[model samples]
Target: MTNFDQLHRFIFNQANVRGEIARLDDSLQHIVHSYEYPVQIQQLLSEMAAATCLLAAILKFKGEIGLQIQGQGALKYAVVNATDDHTLRGVARWDEDLPSLPESFAELMEKGVLVITITPEDGERYQGMVALDKPTLAECIEGYFAQSEQLATKVILRTDLSEPERAKAAGVLLQVMPTKASNTDVAQDTGFEHLCKLTETLSSEELFSLPVEDILYRLYHQEEVEMFEPATIQFACTCSRTRSAEALRNVDKAELLQIVEEEGAVKMNCQYCHTEYRFDSIDVEAIHAGRFEDTATKTQ
Candidate 1:
C-alpha cells in the first residue's frame, strides 16, 4: 500500500519539467468525519485537500495556499487551505439535501468562480480566479495555471468514497519549468510531451495503492527522473482560543455586552475544526477593558 498522507516531488533530469504527487488516506478520513457531509461533498473536499497540498509543496515561499469555489447552486462554497508545512484544513457550505444533483463540475456549481490565493510570509499576497467552465475541477485548475502563470500545466485528481472509513484522495501536478529565453520553444520540447503522456496513464487505483517510488518508476521507467524526499501531510486546524478571543475583542463592545446579557455568555465556534470557545461576563469584561491576559487566565 502507498504511504498515506505523504507528498512527493520529482523532476525530469533531461527536461524543464516538474511534477508532484500527493496522496491522502487518514487525513482525508479525518476531514470527512469532522462534519456530516454528503458523500459527493466529501469526495470534492478530499480532492481539494489533495490539490491544496500538492500546490503548497510546489511553492518556494513560506506561507499558505488556498483554493475556494463559490456558486449560487446548492453548494454555496468550498474551501481548502494548506500551509507550507503540509498541514491542511477545509470546509464546505451548502443547502442540505440538494436534489437531483448533477455530477459535472460546471452543472453542480452554477455561476461559480474558482479562486486560488497564495499568501507568502514576507511578500504580497497573490490571487488568481477562473470561471468554472470545465467538466472537472482538475481541468478548472489547469485553466487557472494557463491564465495566471502562462505555464503549460496538467492536474489530475481522484477520490475514492466507496468506503467511508477508508476514503482516499490522490492527485498529480505537472508543469513546465521556466526555460531560458533562448530555450523558450516549449512546443519543440518533445521530452515534456512524452512525460505528460506517461503521467496520463496513471489510474486512480494505482494512485491510491502503489508506493510513491513504485508509481514513479512505473510511469517514468524510461526517463531519468530525480525524486525528492517526501513530506508528510496532515489534517490540522490552526484555530486557537487566543485567536478567538481577539476576534471577540474586535467586535463592538455594546453588542458583545448585549449578547452576554441575553445568552449569559458569548460563544464562538471554529468552522474549520468545530472547536467552541466560550466567554462569560467576566471574560467579556476583561476583553472590553483590554486585559487580554486576564481574559485568558479566566477562560483557563
Candidate 2:
C-alpha cells in the first residue's frame, strides 16, 4: 500500500519541466477534526492545506509559506501554512448561523483576496496578493505564478469532504521554469503543455489510491522522467504557551491582570488547533516579568 501523507517530485528531463504529486490523509484528518467546521469550509481548508504543502515542497526556501483567503462573505477567513519540511496547519472562520454557504470560491469569498506569504529563515518576508477573480483556488494560483514570476504553471486541487471522518485532500503542481540553456524554450513550453494535458486526465481516486511511481508512469509513460525521493507531509501547529504568552507582551498589563482577577485566568486559544492557553495571576506576572518562557515550557 502507498504510504499516506507523502509528496513525490518528478522532472521531465526532455521537456525541462517539473511536477509534483501529493496525497494527504493524516494531515487532513488532523486539521479537520481540530474544530467543528462546516462541510463547505472543511473542504476549502482541505484544498488550501494540500495546495500549501505542494507549494512549500516545490520552493527552495528554509522557512514557512502561507496561503490565505480573506473577505466578508460566508467564509470570512481561511489560511493554511506549510514549512520547508512540509509540516502544515490551517484554520477557517465563517458565518455559522447562515442557512447555507456558497460552494464556489468566488461566492464564498466575495470581494476576497488570495494571499501568499513567504518567510525565509534568513531573509526578509514577502507577500503577494490578488483579487479572488477566479472560481477556484487552482486558477488563482496559476495566475499568481504568471503575474509574479511570469512562469507557465498548472495547479489542481481535489478534496473529499462528504464524510468528515474520512476527509481526504490531494493535488498536483506543474511549472515550467526558465531554462538557461540556449534554444530550449520552444521545446520546453510544448512539452510542458502536453504534460499538463495528461496531468489533467488524472482522476481523484487514482491520485488518492495509486502508488507514487505508478501515478507518474500512468501519466507520462512515453516521456523521459526522473523521480526523486518523497517528502512526508504532516499537520503540525506551531503554537504553545510560550509563544502565546509572547503574543500578550505588548498588551496592557493592567487589563490582563484585571482579566485574571475577574475571570480567574487570562485565556488564549489557538484558532488553528484549538489548543487553549490559560494564565492565572502567577502566570500573568511571570509573562509580564519576561520570565514565562522557562516556566511555561516546563509545565507544557
Candidate 3:
C-alpha cells in the first residue's frame, strides 16, 4: 500500500524474469533542496538516486554502493550512494553560467564515464566503469548490466523536478531471470521483451502518483505477478562535526589557526545535507591535539 519513498520487487510467474520499482518523493526533495540547483540539475540527481535505489535492491553487500559519473562537458560530475539498509544521498555540480542549459543528459557531457564502486565491509573494494555514451542515465546503466553482467536488462528512469520542493522520481528495472528454463529455451521465449514493453508504457504521471499495487496492475494485469515485501527508502547523510574534524585533520594546524584568526572561525559545510560546522581556535587546537577519537573515515 505504500505510495512513495519505497521499493518493491515483483516477478512474473509465467516468465523467467524479475523486476524492481522504486518510488522516491520525500527522499528526492531532501536531496533536490540541499542546494538551489536548476530543474535540469535536480532531475539528473533524481535519476541517479532512483537508479541507486533500484541497483541496491538487486545487489547484495555488507557496506555501500556508489555510482558516479564525470564528464568533460557542462556537468562536471554527479554521484549517489546507497547502503544496504536503503539509506541514500546524492549531489551534483555543473557550469552555472551557461547561456542556455541542455535538456538531455548526453548533451551535458562531451566524454563521460560512469563508475560503480562496491565497498564491502570485510572485503576489497571493487570498481566497474561504463562509458556514458548513451543518451540517458537509464540506458547507460542498462549498458553497464549488458557489459558487466551479460544480462538482458532494461532500465526506465523517470523524474519530475519542475517543482523542486515537491520533486518525485521513480525507476523500473527489468531483467531476464536465470533458470533451467532459460537454459532450455533461450530462443523461443519472448516474455522478457513483452514485459519490458508493458513497463515502458508507464508514464511519469502514473509512476509518481499511483500506489505500488495499482501500478503493478496497470503494467501486468494479464500476467501473474508475485509481489514480495517492500522496503522503505530514505535520505541519510553521514556527515557530522566529527567527520568534519576528521576531514580537517589532513590540513596543517597552523593554516587552520590562521583561517580561524582571520574569519573568527573556520567553517565547513556538508554538501550532501548543507549542514555547516564551525570551529574556533580552541576546537582547532583540540582537534590537532587529539581530543577526538580517530577512526578510518572518508568525507561524505
CA lDDT scores, all candidates in order = 0.83, 0.84, 0.84
For residue 16, model 2's alpha carbon misses the true position, in angstroms, by 1.5
List candidate 3 stretches off by more than 4 Å. Answer: 162-164, 178-190, 293-300
lDDT of 3 by residue, 134-194 (tens): 8999999988977886667889999886664788888999887655554225413846778
> 80-174 in candidate 1: lDDT tens per residue?
99999999999998778766566666766789999999999999999989998888899999888778777778788999888867788999998
For every model shown, what is its TM-score relative to the native structure?
0.93, 0.93, 0.88
Task: State, as a TM-score between 0 and 1, how close model 3 is to the true structure.
Answer: 0.88
lDDT of 2 by residue, 45-87 (tens): 8899888988997568699999999998898889999999989
Model 1 spans with C-alpha error above 4 angstroms = 180-184, 294-300
Residue 186 C-alpha lDDT in model 1: 71
> What's every prediction's RMSD, in angstroms?
2.4, 2.4, 3.5
